[model samples]
Target: MDATKMAAVGLSASYGRGPAITDINLEFGPNSATAIIGPSGCGKSTFIRCLNRMHETAPRATVTGKVFLDGEDIYEQDPTAVRRRIGMVFQRPNPFATMTIFDNVAAALRFNGRHSREETDKIVYESLQAAALWEEVKDHLFAGATSLSGGQQQRLCIARALAAQPEVLLMDEPCSALDPISTAKVEDLIFTLKRTYTVIIVTHNMQQAARVADRTAFFYLGKLIEVNDTKEIFERPKEKLTEGYVSGRFG
Candidate 1:
């Protein structure tokens, strides 16, 4: 599948008071993985939220500039549709407490008004396979989502996101809370995800960024400092601020 093209032009966002991101501009290509890295409160999460129009969901939040998906401004389109096409997986695994594993992935299908049992089953199975969870959960399709381990639950969330067939996946610290093994699994899944979906990840772990991202964008104080290939960003950053942060001089 050809990757979807997306860009944010002169984007700035505020929470009814101060700007969280300022005059930010960036472009993303299909089937590419870009990592947004910075310290806490540097707007890494906020920027990705704006990409899919989720930032506006906050109370009294305000946004300026345009986010384009396939050359059309997303802010001018239905927010729900924008989100479905650009799915987000959060830092924590937040599976539906009451739903079974199958139901969790199926929820997305149901929301889109797809009701055929045969098709739903097929989609659910395929999505689980895509998420790299089918082998682990195939026998327990009806198990409660909460019954899974932290890692399994996170993959389940990824499966849920995949069921919608999003062209882009915005993962905000998706593995921060998991153990090393689980984190590795999610990282591997990310590499596979970018083969067909555009991936934008916000992570404080620079090493993780290097492992998964094709290109890395560095942000500081709500502004983009430098962006380049992951190796260049770490070995030869052009901006002093980026150099300091990546070199462990300051975070």
Candidate 2:
């Protein structure tokens, strides 16, 4: 599948009364990873949600400005198509409790409705392998998804997203609820996935951002404070605010 570059222009979002993020502009290249780093309620989550049209799904939420996927405006495209091309994983592992591990991955392919049973099986296997989960779950494909540990569940969710063959993947604090070992596994998976998929991850863990992201964007109350290469962002940030936040002086 072809990877997609994403850009936001004059972007802003609001929950009816006040804006969550305002006039933010950023560009992400294909097959790269960019981390969105900020404190709680800094609009990091809202901003990533807008990338794939998830923000507008919230009640009373509205977005202004444009998000472009490979130069085409996402807002002007069909919402279902936009979402299909961009897949999301939430903060918590959210496997369908009733579905088997294989079914969970197959469900995404089924929803797209173009693949035959043979093709679906192939995709599911490949996705699980891509997520580095195949070795652990291959023996229990038909078992309940919730039977896996928290980390395994998260990896299964990633495999499900991969099964869609999305051009872009959006992850919102995907490792926040996992143990240190689980978090490290996910981090390694992120590093590997960027070789083929453009990934945007919203995370509160600064070190995780440093470990996984090639580029880093720092957000503050409703605005983007700074963005730069990961090394520069951590070592020699141009903005004092960015320095303060990264240095643990203040958030």
Candidate 3:
């Protein structure tokens, strides 16, 4: 594989006693998008959350494995630093309610370090542009974040994450809450984003996975059943489990 931006080796995560995901070994290449697809409770979300140490935020959660970023063990680094390098977007839109659209993105830049107003402004604008929300809200940058529609709010959250200059973006069912039109917009943005960032998205929408991902991984009962080219996985899965899931015979 071309130099991977991130990899997980013998990774497992759990809440207290029972493991949610077990021994996941995967690699994500630079500048490509990978979709994790499985039925609900299949550990798709749990696996990605462990990627950036977000899994530890849960009560009594434990992780035992190695996650490497560019050949460096991320578990040995500061959790905050690891998260900054691997930003995430949740299933629902979660822009800060009190901050304006510009401020929401600016908050990420400010949190990373001190920047002059001009520098912050430039980054905020560019981030918004990257999320494809600039033209819609440029004139009202100071408007409250909650004022935007559901789709706009989700894109704003994406812009906020981008403002942090992350190398990888993890999206857990990012469009599950949006209408079809909004979902299409986010899909377009995903296409644009994979050109620069290594993107990993966990989605239950098989069609969405087929549309947006270069590769797709299927998980079943907390285990990764198969990982392969999107076309191959959908059309000709190597494993029987993968074939059954892709063919809608079982989840």
Cα lDDT, all candidates: 0.93, 0.94, 0.94
Clashes of 3: 0
Could you tell me how far off, in angstroms, the CA of residue 58 lies in candidate 1 after the best superposition?
A: 0.9
- lDDT, candidate 2, equals 0.94
Q: Tens digits of per-residue lDDT for model 2 on 1-251?
A: 24339999999999888999999999898888999998899999999999999999999999999999989999999999999999999999999999999999998778677888899989999999999999999888999999999999999999999998899999999999999999999999999999899999999999999999999999999899999888999999999999999998877
lDDT of 1: 0.93
TM-scores of all predicted structures: 0.97, 0.97, 0.98
Number of clashes in every candidate structure? Answer: 0, 0, 0
Cα RMSDs of all predictions?
1.7, 2.0, 0.8
Expressed as tens digits, the lDDT of each residue in 55-146 for candidate 3 is 99999999999999999999999999999999999999999999988899999777778999999999988999999999999999999999
User: Which segments of candidate 2 are over 4 A away from where they belong?
Assistant: 1-4
Give the residue spans of candidate 3 off by over 4 A: none
Per-residue lDDT value at 34 in model 3: 98
Return whichever of 1 and 3 wins on TM-score.
3
For model 1, what is the error of residue 42's alpha carbon versus the real structure, in angstroms, after optimal superposition? 0.2
